[model samples]
Target: MNNKTKSILYGTLASSILLGVYFTVLTLVSGWSFTQ
Candidate 1:
């Protein structure tokens, strides 16, 4: 894989993990409800 492709993959993975952590924290704080 090229440097560009590796960078893109890493960026995407980091963003997704951050998003997942944000959502999980939000859900826990909101008592497992999607509506916040």
Candidate 2:
């Protein structure tokens, strides 16, 4: 793959993982309940 394509793919993957972890932490810290 080209540098531009690889960079874009990596950026997208990193952002998604970061956002997932951010939300998971936020929910745990806030004691969010999904079974309510």
Candidate 3:
């Protein structure tokens, strides 16, 4: 694989992980708020 392709793949993977974490945190916060 080429360097450019490798970087793109890594960046995409990182972005997906970050988005997943953001959503999970958001849900947790909302759930906690609901319980109050």
Candidate 4:
């Protein structure tokens, strides 16, 4: 894998993790149950 591909993969992984965390926090704050 080239540097560009590695960088893109890292960026995508980071963004997805951040987005998941944000949504999890939002759900908790909104009192939505995750285990339904």
Model 2 vs. true fold: TM = 0.83
Q: Higher-TM-score candidate among 1 and 3? A: 3
Q: Give per-residue CA lDDT, model 1, range 1-36, as digits (tens).
A: 999999999999999999999888888888765744
Model 2: worst 10 consecutive residues (lDDT sum): 27-36
lDDT string, candidate 3, 1-36, tens digits: 999999999999999999999878877988766545
| Residue pairs with backbone overlap in model 1 | none
TM for every model, in the order presented, reads: 0.81, 0.83, 0.82, 0.82
Summing lDDT over every window of 10 consecutive residues in candidate 1, give the lowest-scoring window.
27-36
Please list the residue runs of candidate 3 whose C-alpha ends up more than 4 Å from where it truly belongs after superposition. 32-36
lDDT scores in order: 0.89, 0.87, 0.88, 0.89
- Stretches of candidate 2 above 4 Å error? 33-36
Rank the candidate models, highest TM-score first. 2, 3, 4, 1
TM-score of 3: 0.82
Model 3: number of backbone collisions: 0
Off by over 4 Å in 4: 33-36
Writing each residue's lDDT as its tens digit, candidate 4 over 1-36 gives 999999999999999999999988888877676624
